[model samples]
Target: MPLRNPCALLPRRLQVVASLTLAVLLFILLLGSHPTSTSSTDYIHRVPYGPAIQSSAHQLVENLPQIPHDLPHVNTPAWLNPFRGPAHTPPPEQANSSSGEARWYTDFKWRNPFSSDTTLDEERAVLPPLAERARVYTYFESTSKDDKTKKIELELLQVWRRAWWAQGFKPIVLGKPEAMNNPLYRAVQGLELEDAMEKEMMRWLAWGNMGTGILSNWLAVPMAAKDDTLLEFLRRGEFPSLTWYKGLESGMFVGSRGEIEKAVKEAIAFPAINTTKSMFEAVGKETFAVEADHGAIAFYSSATITAKYPLLATKLSSPSTAVQGLALLPQLINSHLHTTWQNTFSSGIAVLKPLPAHTTTLIQPALDIARNLSQCPSTPIPASCPPNKPRCKPCVSNNMLISVPPVLRNTSSLFTIATVPHPYTLTSLLHSRLDLGVKFVRRETDRDSWTVAATKELLGTGLSSFSRLPALKDFVAGSYGEARTLWLVAEEPVRGDSELDLDALDWHFGFQLPRSPVSDGKSVTPVPGPERRPPPPKEEFGEGPPLSEQELMTERSMFMQAQMILRDSATGSAKGKTRGGSKSFAQTREVVEAWNLADTEVWRFVRAWDARRQLERRGWEEEEEGFLGKGTFGRWIDKIT
Candidate 1:
């Protein structure tokens, strides 16, 4: 009995192992006896990659590391040697010139900027010239009729002029008590109050040929003077500071003359949308339903563009005024002939939503003409297209409108009007540099639940087609920027604290918001800093509070240094001096310098959004429906059939 079963005498572990081995052998035999049509070998052959190999069966495989783990350690063959041998050997290049074309899987390109270095050249090319002369255009909207209030506003403007003078820029004071009466001010009355004000100020600045300017409502003091050096950085095109703001200040804007002109041209090209039926009837038939609230009406105007055969109704606040961004249809149409086609073509129409809809009446006719032009064919010179200018026509349907104005009829591309939810102030102030990023600051206070509710409703329902998405940051580099729009909606209501209010309006409206009492016309003291803090340290003779002098100076100095670094790196590249290790080192330095001065919160988000977009776009390319081998064929079939 003791010798009968060696397995029974074995240890517990050995006994269990023997039983498992027998079970496996029995199972394999059962599988082999009743083989299915698809065998394991056939299944293995159908695997996505090559057939699975029994690496463990090889003699030396047991000690060899795994495939990926040891892949880098594998010795290179002599044929694959990258180095050039002797002088007799032909020179070798790493990349084949013939195969330089982008590959579907291997090659990649970023549609949006992920790094400052990638866009440095583009940014440099678009930088605004630091003009020889700079002028200050200020606007102050007064709710109080008291003479004392007007006096204080004038004093504030004087303070700003003195500040600019200290920085060596001539300050032409164009501020008056009635400055806010400009038509742009009225257009944005019901929406984006501060942003509209800034745009109105920008138009006035541009018309005056004031190359350098600031738009402020005299609510807060100037943070810095017009910076030409910064303009140099801005002209390069990438993340240029076209519109700047301080954390705790009033609608502070400093931009180049070029920015003003560019914005004015865009504003003029596309008229503002007039919500009044009488005015809209003039542009085209008022097809869309009109909402009652200011915000809702604004939403409908902009959202209208997303429709099939979309027609936009845009009107300038006052077309008759020479300083008006959308003045005199005939003269404005002629002015477009001298500008680059991209100036008119790339940007269709951008409308400021104006009140007192009368001023915008003339723009309707122009918009109708543009809508007809959009319908004109993209190819083979339509008779209506001008011989000299051939660009993307603003087309609606295939049918041509013979009633179109003679000057506008022959134009290659008619401007597509973009009726924005907010006034085009931020759009105009930043001008083309607006593509970098946009941040909207909304002030929701417990005092006004109606406002909070209205804000949430507008933001949630998608004021513009872009804001419809929940992840605004995700859309920053793509849809929002692509659409040339930025709508910063508040997620929830906030307490009306000075700091919180200042931060919300920081990007577009930097002024310290008036408190409930002040807004209600009650007398309240204007404290420079936060409401509770001791007054900020004043400049000599207590002229005004100097809050950001050191910070501003430091910022300006850093930008100057970065400018020099960029110049040197560019020169090195041009001269072909830096190559190999030196070239790479220079490039690394260039990247660091490009973003060295970008410390503002807006830029921080811009960089983060861009990086995320790059990563997503890369991953998306492998599975995107539009690509050749991706899902294009399936999508095409789905569409055709």
Candidate 2:
């Protein structure tokens, strides 16, 4: 208070001047140690703090604006961050290792889904050596002490070995006299019996290197007729036309070694390949490169050829013996035309006749054979009778003559149950005559009108569920008493036929696929201390080599002759005098040659068709049951939501 009195005493104008001089002095004192800059005043004017301080003390609050707490909106990508540009970038080593491009990009080394080394090894270990590659597993359980049963088993084994030999594979029988007493043997036999055959089939296809396997019971003998053993049929250059389940007998599979390995690899990598419901479904989706099991003998046999030789896969349509039958007359005509007119026949060959829709008309050829065999007028009474029967019976042809149409249903309906003389057996004979085209129709239907093919197809609806599935449920659900009985009888070979009597017996078959055709990297013919042949000289690039006109003509003639032979042999003729049987010649040589040429393609087509047909039947049944609209909950959800 005392010092303030001196300034108050001075004049007002002098006081103001004195105050300004003091302020300048104070600013100079504070800035004395720092470097002087003209830009300081401009910097102070640009800052918000400087402007607020310059305002009157009471008005400072009004000049300054409030700071914002909310974040600013941004739409820019992370890479385009302005604040963290090149100058603020961190070293890659210090940045996130698991993020960005490194994490998102795929490595080429681990691309295959099936590339599990451990899994591959385990699967490979299950396969036997090359010497034992193609194995056909079968079981027989008989609980009787009869000579007939013993003879049947012996005959069956002989036929099985013959069929296996024809297919170029070794047969290993898995049954014994004491097979019924051992629990372990029974378990193995049961697995072969109860498992759905398709699993082993796929396994064989994947692992079998050009190996064919059959997993069937003792009843599944390979014979042209019941009485004709497999060996006899092969000797005569014939295959059985009538088989259990038609084309699909019991567990049968065929494929090349390379394809089976490839398929297995693909299946391991992509599980869906073996998980499809039907073979055709797999084909439709191309899930697997190999063919599917169609449960038909024709399909299995034909597809084996296609699998071995890739060229025939797409060369034919409806590659079945049935279609081949209709081409017989036309092929014969073409052969005659070629032999007569030579060059003129090339421009116009005869078209094949359409297959008759009526079952009776198609079966006529087969029926004629039966008639001729039954009427052996020259033989004595007992010798003239059909083999294996006790007495002579009236000829089927004579009985059918009374009916106007001579149809199976009308002609056989008159016979009582006891006097029928097993008419059903004749069906196979007819089937053989028709090139295995006959379809068996069962009684009991709701509809009144239908074509023969359509009727048979309709009857087949829901059949796979009952037939294709393994009998596992029946075995598992069986009581302890029955299980004990099975155990007790495991090694004991009772004289019971699995085919006819199944009350106390059960069996199953299993097979493994082989890795290679030749075993242990060894040649079929061993070399003498690695002696090698010299390499052939290479030819020039231009047009290869020259051929004479005579050589070219010879090749063409031979090719045409081969084609004729195939058509002639695909379906055999009855070779009976008069028009009684088919008027065609039974050319066994042609049959064998044609089979060798076309067996693969035929098997491929039939098997694929079997899958397609089975699928179709299932769909048709589902539609009839109203399951298509109501059963699928996914569709309901889609419709509602």
Candidate 3:
């Protein structure tokens, strides 16, 4: 017997209704199984089902019956509470009181769940005494006869001394007079200046035998005083007898005095030329005619010594073998600095795009001027410039020259190109003509090398200027433009003043009044004013008292609230859309405005608290001034008395 159709059993109207209901159920199941892609705006606006389910489960758990207070509890094993050992039992008087209920969760107490149980006092006990700390020696040889250069070197030495002293390390400065006493120094006195400097450091290290010490150059500034890995290595005495920076041995040296002395003596006795040739042969390169410095000689000698005595020397790049190494004390190479500056200048110009027609027209002429300046003859022409005059040369390589094109001199447009001294003057002139209302504020320095003082001044000025400009702040906070203008100025100069080998001519531009605003054959140059010294280092090093626990907690809570506000605003933007079915830009603007207001209020509160703290600290300082005087030495004197 064949089965009849299911629809034959029902009435005609009921059969049609049953077929429609089955089709609707099938559609619902398919729709739920495969979700369609949604726009970002829709995705943000979608309801969160995860939190809803979590809340429902939490409610169910809360409705369930809890364990009775009178139920017998099992004691947890001591091994389970490894952080704090076994749980403590309540006293006899409090055992039967209401506090007994609190003891039910006593097994969960953790002194420090994240770290070992070793106390800070135990760590401090193993630290070496101040006198026993490793000594770091830096050699300062003033090759430049410029008084300004010497003054800068002295200032750097003072900074270095303070940095090392703060970290409980002894820093010693070596000079020409100290090196003259070493017999090894006298043997290698006839070498070239750079080679001689290296040999001098080696001789001093060998002769001094100053226990565990480091040999470093003056150019290597201390970025941080405290390195836990370095400190632990020193504390445990786990390093080999002689340890140097991994890639380059000359950058830094750290070792015990005895091993370093032996290594230095062997390096000094080795023939420099033969060492260079051997190194070239080892690398499968032909021996080229180049002067062998102390670095090469030392590397060769150390390799030879290590072959016989494996434990005498080692090279380290990181704290452990498993971790990658980073340069802690980077040697500032001139070529590297020039490349970095070029990249920065190009990238900065690249971000300002879709330039005005007027700005775009001036770029080619500027490039021509740059090319002309770069190709100018080495000698000064009397026809182009008169003798005994500052403007004798068509172009000068020094940083002092601020060249302005003849066209924009009288345009009534405010254009300032703040940049380092590049080989091309046209780059700065073009930057000024961009009409961005930007004040390019570059710190002027006397030295050829980049200085910390210059960096601080530049950063401070930029930050202060940014804080005052709402447009700049918005540009930084929002994504607005793409970087595509770099190719436009790719033909510009790639070298700076430091990379040039020519002597800088003392040239200044003579600006004549009643000059035509149009492009003329004559270029306008404004003489830079007298040099200004950077602010004192004390402000950079000085730190105020740390934030109180309450202040810290407030900051954490505010940060969390700010994060939540940002997240909610992102999702709520779709809800605040107009009738056009688009996310409202007005809503975004309102959110940003609200955030700025909240930020202003928060800053005001912080400033008020800081002012109050300063006042309190001042009062305490004034009270102590009577006995401590003004300096740290005075406080020590008072203590001694």
Predicted model with the maximum TM-score: 3
Q: Pairing residues by index, what is the TM-score of model 2?
A: 0.17
Report the lDDT tens digits of candidate 2 across residue range 184-284.
33323423221333343333332233223444443232311111233232323221221223233333433333443443344334335435443333333
**Candidate 1: stretches off by over 4 Å:** 1-151, 154-504, 510-641
What lDDT does each candidate get? 0.30, 0.28, 0.32
TM-score of 3: 0.25
**Weakest 10 consecutive residues, lDDT, candidate 2?**
415-424
Candidate 1 similarity to native, TM-score: 0.20
| Per-prediction tally of clashes | 30, 42, 0
Error of 3 at 162 (Å): 2.7
Give the Cα error of residue 607 in candidate 2, in Å.
44
lDDT per residue as tens, model 3, 105-218: 111111121101222211010111113445667665556565544454454454444444333345566545445555556654554334544645443544344445666554
Residue 78, model 2: lDDT of 58
lDDT-wise, the better of 1 and 2 is: 1
Consecutive 10-residue window with the lowest summed lDDT within model 3:
503-512
What ranges in model 3 sit over 4 Å off? Answer: 1-131, 186-211, 224-227, 234-239, 273-641
